[model samples]
Target: MAKKGHSEEQILRALRQAEGGTRVADICREHGISEATYYIWKKKYSGLGLSELRELRQLREENSKLKHLVADLSLDRHILQEIVQNKAVRPRHRRELGRWTQAVFALSTRRVSGLMMLNRATMNYQSRRDPQHALRTRMRELAASRVRFGYRRLTVMLRREGWKVNAKRIYRLYTEDGLAVRTKVRKKIARRARVPALRATRPNERWSMDFVAARLIDGRWFRVLTVVDQFTRECVLLLADSSLTGQKVASALSQVIAERGAPMSITVDNGIEFASKAMDAWAYQYGVQLNFIRPGRPVENGYIESFNGRLRDECLNVEVFFALIDVRDKLERWRRDYNQVRPHGALSDSAPAVFAAQWTDTAVPGPEPVPDRTGKPAAGNSLEILT
Candidate 1:
């Protein structure tokens, strides 16, 4: 007789009796099993009950059905292959079979000295005979003429020049010719002088101010005082001041505060106007942290530096400024457009407005505290600026 294994129902019944204080020896005798077998069953099925046994039975039936299905599939596959091989199928089916046979024969051959074999030499010769080398050369030259051009754009330019080539093929050649340029890696500079790291997560959390010098079209010299939002890349203030002193900067900052409220910190380079006691006192009075970039490192304040370049190129470069009002109007218009519509490729081609709009109040931890001038509790959302 074949050795009997414990059925799920039998194991569960034994476990139920064992849990009810039935002795293992008696339970084993009643089940007609040895003590070792009883222990093994207890270990395997002690926690299982009637519901679990029923589920196991269902799973076993499913597994048997799946096995039968797989066997039937294998048999059916063989029958289908036979039908496809038969001459009774469509002419297209026979043609496909013939192509497959040819491909297999070509792949299996060693082709010693090539007695008419489809080999690497034949493939290379066909590629050379395709008459697209001239078109490919033109595409490469066009891509080089532009500072940088992707294959799709190159394909467009080629088509405009009457090349009639596919964009996919151009892309293949573009990558194959090693034309891809890797993006420049940005490194975070470390603070060595024990200065506290300025934390700003929202617009106006921190402001950075700097002076950029440029000559008017008449060759008269002046300075551009630019104040930028450290978080949102917004230009908070801009002025075409002829002679900027510490008092002037403080006065401008005060005006900005009256308009847009005070920022938590102001980062600046070590210019004399920025380092003055008057500017420092004004910043301190408003409870604003003053930060200075490292000496001689212009890139330390890179955001403002980049902003200045764009301001010059887009606005200042296009006009002649005879008066401060003219400069002011152009600067204001450019700043508005820059913040609202100009796309920043560095920020994934998002405009500053779109980028700022994504920042929910939940993203910021809390507003900084500021005191009211009257020493009384201010209304909601107005921070108290402590001296």
Candidate 2:
């Protein structure tokens, strides 16, 4: 970076233009250099004349040469320290100038060897063995076995195996094997824009309906058909039984319509139950739109999905069902509380019933309460047929 290979004059001129507020992109294109390269030159020659830049290069060259000399001095210091610590001086040196002849000064290798009374070959000896050769092998084995183990973990593993290796050495071998851990790449799911989840502009403008299931004491599974008003977050209806037929669904919807009128459109998934002849007939009869979401995408019907989650978590998960009667009673109580007591965050922390009440005049009349069962069960005896 210090020697960019371009003339100093060219670099200083680019810096001047950059300081004058021209954009970096324009400067890079005009100069045929990368943005990074331009920044590097700009930083080095900022507010300096060409002559000053030349002087700085010369000074840097001198500093590097001085560093080299200091390194040589450090090597000489270590040789003297080793000789005194070992006390390995020959008796010939002791006979002559005592330790002076044994001292290792910064002389030629041959002269230093003669002065210390050691062989010249020993003074010029070099270590050709690579200390990390075994370490690299072990690191490769660990990497092949455990792909997730990074350099730090490999360091700990190596130390436990009685090898004296550090994290820095392992990292060097790790890169030598091209073994950097791969980053997870997120795939973009192929999403074609469907119409957004329809937000109801007003009460009864849109409705989200879905089915949830639970079991009775006899281990008989029952389905709960839930209908929610999207605008007010209101639970308009909950019908639970051993089975819900398409005709029964139509009848329940008819009752809601008779009371509160009909929604502008009903949002549902493409289930067989929602696509039944009875449902289609009912929609045509009441002039209501049946908006079915695409198959396999439940989030399109999120409002009902959220309601179903709360119902299961709070009611079904807690209660032990004894019979259809118990489920019915608990469901009735919970549904009432959900509409009248529980404050919905979407409705400004107001209960769904409270929020709906403000626009009751606009909403169709709600269903009339059915008479209490003091006598025998209704025809078919299933909870779905009762109402």
Candidate 3:
């Protein structure tokens, strides 16, 4: 019906009239078209409507564009893959590229930069940064004095001294100055699958113990035995001494057990004092299971380890202990507050002592009941005497 190259929608609409029983010759004559063309359209798209024919044409065009885009990407990937093979530019490659740029003086700067895949400004500009000579000198002084300190430690010390510099920048300059910390190679140990230990659902069900060390004001080193309840997160005991053997540790636990009752299980590391015969005998006597963590692994007993870190940070690090009596007094006060005052998130924002007391209160019955009054009319009724 329409001229050639017009939308298929127009032709399909005209053909619909012919399909309604109008003579083909008359339809073609009225629509200014030939019978041969009409027949070609009917053979190809007799069952299709105008919308379907238009959609089919759009899909063909989109498919053609997608194919061309995929081909272009493949060509680009191949070209980049062979770049290294074309030239084995190694040491002094930047210098070589610079010379090539100068040799092509007749060419435009943009054209030469495009060929090299570099920016014109990068090729022309020179850095004006001041080499931090003073900072490097100070870092060397600290590193030399403390041979065991690494770059990260040096960064901390620098911050303490009011120097503002980042670790990345210091590390680059440290390497350029040939200042590297010596590191020890650790031997790899074979590991075996281990059964996971059960978590305690209530206080006294499980307890974790670990040791912490600190120096007194007079530089005398002392150790503290830290025992914590896994369920309540309460510090049950703190034993401090200049020297604590397996027997002494066991003795301390016995006294605490005698007062508060024995735990169902005790979690500990594979330290000599914990794995000794003294501890084993105590465990057997009390009928308490001794759960030992894997060799060289402390995360299995994470509760006591976290508690020990907090003790070191909050008490051991801040106070300067002058005597063993002083240590006892300070640690006892802190432990009391830790259990009764400090709120533990794991215990629903209540203190460990408070949480444990709640369970005990629920378990035990309340005070004696009061006597019941029966066989009486309600209150405020007065009976009349004989008149």
Specify the highest-TM-score model's number: 1
**Each model's TM-score?**
0.46, 0.44, 0.45
Worst 10 residues of 1 by lDDT: 108-117
For each candidate, the alpha-carbon lDDT, in order, equals: 0.68, 0.74, 0.75
Write one digit per residue (lDDT tens) for candidate 3, span 12-94: 87679888889999878877778988887777667887787778667877888899989866754554454444462442344
- The TM-score of candidate 3 is 0.45
Best by lDDT: 3
| Candidate 1 C-alpha RMSD relative to the actual structure | 26.4
**What residue pairs clash in candidate 3, if any at all?**
none
Clashing pairs in 1: 370-383, 370-384, 370-385, 371-384, 371-385
Which 10-residue window in model 2 sums to the lowest lDDT?
Answer: 378-387
Worst 10 residues of 3 by lDDT: 377-386
Cα lDDT for residue 73, model 3?
67
lDDT preference between candidates 2 and 3, better one: 3
* Model 2 C-alpha lDDT per residue in residues 138-206, reported as the tens digit of each score: 888977754555787677667767988778878867875788876458688787877676577666668
Candidate RMSDs in Å, in order, are 26.4, 29.3, 26.2
Clashing residue pairs, backbone N/CA/C < 3 A, model 2? 259-365, 260-364, 260-365
